[model samples]
Target: MKTCLVVDDSGVVRKVARRILEDLSFSVREAADGQAALVCCEEFMPDGILLDWNMPVMEGLEFLLELRKRDGGDVPRVIFCTTNNDIEHIAKAIASGANEYIMKPFDSDILREKLEEVGLIEKVDP
Candidate 1:
């Protein structure tokens, strides 16, 4: 199963993401902040990451920069998942190496679309 790291300060957000990713057949790992996410990454190389913007300890942008600085071949593709939907914030998240961005309070279909966009899901036979 593909592994996914979910980094968010909110426990509910983490649980929701974990459930969604697991439903898509991904093995989900969770962190409350960027610091914990880094540790999780070192321990296990995840195929993808879902990061939150406003977190305690280390924020999402800082985490992305740190991940880039590390010399590792198995760097996970990242998606910034947060409530912040400002144009500038979106640009910054993409600039910081996020492959995609997801607005919060997303429905199941939206979440599935994100997974498909990242090649984690395939289209079903009609």
Candidate 2:
């Protein structure tokens, strides 16, 4: 199964995302913040990452920059999932190497769509 890391400060968000990702056929893992996420990545690089902004210890942007610098880091399809929906934030995320972006309060369909757009999952008919 494809592996994914869900990085978020909120337990509820992590749990929800975990279920959604699992339903999409990914082996899911969780990290409370970017620092913890980096440690997880170092141990084993996941096939994809569902990241959040405004996290403690290290923000999503910072973590993405650092991750891109690491060996094999470029392989993960990173999708930034956050409440920051402004053009600046979205542009910054894409420029920093995120494959796609998802707004907060997203559903399984939205997540699946973004994952497909990013090439992490195959497209499916509704």
- Best candidate per lDDT, number? 2
Q: Tens digits of per-residue lDDT for model 1 on 1-126?
A: 898999999999999889888888999999999999889878887889989999999999898889877766236778899999999999998987888899998767787788778776786555
How well does candidate 2 match the true structure in TM-score terms? 0.98
Compose the digit string of candidate 2's lDDT tens values, residues 1-126: 999999999999999999999998999999999999999999999999999999999999999999999999999999999999999999999999999999999999899999999888899976
lDDT of 2 at 100: 93
Models, CA RMSD each? 1.5, 0.6
What's the lDDT for all of these models?
0.86, 0.95
**Alpha-carbon RMSD, candidate 1:** 1.5
Candidate 2 off by > 4 Å: none
User: TM-score of every model?
Assistant: 0.93, 0.98
| Candidate 2 local Cα displacement, residue 34, angstroms | 0.6
